[model samples]
Target: MPQPTPDRDDQARLFREVVLVLGGVFAVQKTDDETIRRVAAGLERVYRRARQNQRSTTSSQALAPHPAIAGLLRITEAEGDEP
Candidate 1:
């Protein structure tokens, strides 16, 4: 006897549905305290490192003046006007 094979299209649809369900589970976990704690504990270091790099990049960009603004400042200073 031969075993029954699943339809390829049905298998693909099932895979998509599983991904969608997992996404929904994560979305729901965003507000659930127990799930949040479990996820945070598991990914705390990964999240912290990502956030740290993000903050550092944002702050450095914020602190650095744009090249056009710097050029304007230099022109004003050369003209003896305070920038």
Candidate 2:
């Protein structure tokens, strides 16, 4: 099983926060340039880490109780059509 790297987890939390703020601004139908810049900065940090290192076992995309990559599996008890 893979665990999330500390950095990535922090990024996810930060992203959630940003969304909250963005939503608030959107509710008022106002654009906050500063907020957008901050969000962009956060995304840049995430991208830099992703480019420099592979995801840890705990990356969000890799759900627990399931393998990180599902499409990699091509098996079934009964034959079924590919989605």
Best by TM-score: 2
Off by over 4 Å in 2: 30-83
> Model 1 clash pairs?
none
lDDT of 2 at 73: 42
Encode model 2's per-residue lDDT on 1-83: one tens digit a residue.
88988877986786678668766875687667787788678667766676467655664574443462244243432235645
Which candidate leads in lDDT? 2
How many backbone overlaps does candidate 2 show? 5
In model 1, which regions exceed 4 Å deviation? Answer: 1-6, 31-83
- Error at 10, model 2, angstroms: 0.4
- Shift in Å, residue 52, candidate 1: 40
